[model samples]
Target: MKNNLRGKIREFLASEDGKVSVKAPLTLGVVTGGIFLAQAIIGPTSATACPCQHDWQCPNPPHICSVGTCIGG
Candidate 1:
């Protein structure tokens, strides 16, 4: 089992085909940018942000508050 795995690794490294993997920073940036873009495009729904004071006092319950806006159930 170990020898087979080692041979496969050596073969993979010897070949120029599979070594070109995505860069970590680029991948992370792309993912983060995608999330940010989605948020910007979709923005925040009332379900995500409800305007009010206090949890129960707020019109909606179990919602999170962002900059005085509540978001949740």
Candidate 2:
């Protein structure tokens, strides 16, 4: 069993595709994709800023109040 494990490790280390140089890119891509997927799943509902003031308030709960008007921002 030990020899089999050692052989596998040696084969991984000696081969070009099994080496860290080749695997690092694939690992990085997988990690980056996972981060993006998590962000997409748990990201903020609105992608804009919601401004407010003391006197006036936004008509819409989440709509932004800019220049005394409500727009997407």
Candidate 3:
């Protein structure tokens, strides 16, 4: 069974149909690598401050916390 599979693999590898040109694999590898690189290099998700007390926690420094949200003082 293994030998038959091996023979078939050898036949496929020897055939021109199974042989892909260098550019296809290179382009695929480059695109795949770029996607992975982009994912890895992406920064942490920054959540916008909604409910605040101090001016720093508010979206704008001109606003102060009124009730829960920051509103213009």
Model 3 C-alpha lDDT per residue in residues 21-64, reported as the tens digit of each score: 54467679999999888867984334333566566565555766
* Residues 1-73 of candidate 1: C-alpha lDDT, one tens digit per residue: 9999999988876566544543455578899999999999987665425455656544455664556765676
Number of the predicted model whose lDDT against the real structure is largest: 3
Error of 3 at 51 (Å): 29
Task: Evaluate model 2: give its TM-score.
Answer: 0.39
List the lowest-lDDT window of 10 residues for candidate 1: 17-26
**How much RMSD separates candidate 1 from the native structure?**
10.5
lDDT tens readout by residue for model 2, 1-73: 9999999988887788676675788889999999999988987654333455522355455556666556553
Cα deviation in Å at residue 10, candidate 2? 7.7
TM-score of each: 0.39, 0.39, 0.32
True-structure lDDT of candidate 2: 0.68
RMSD of each predicted structure: 10.5, 8.1, 8.5
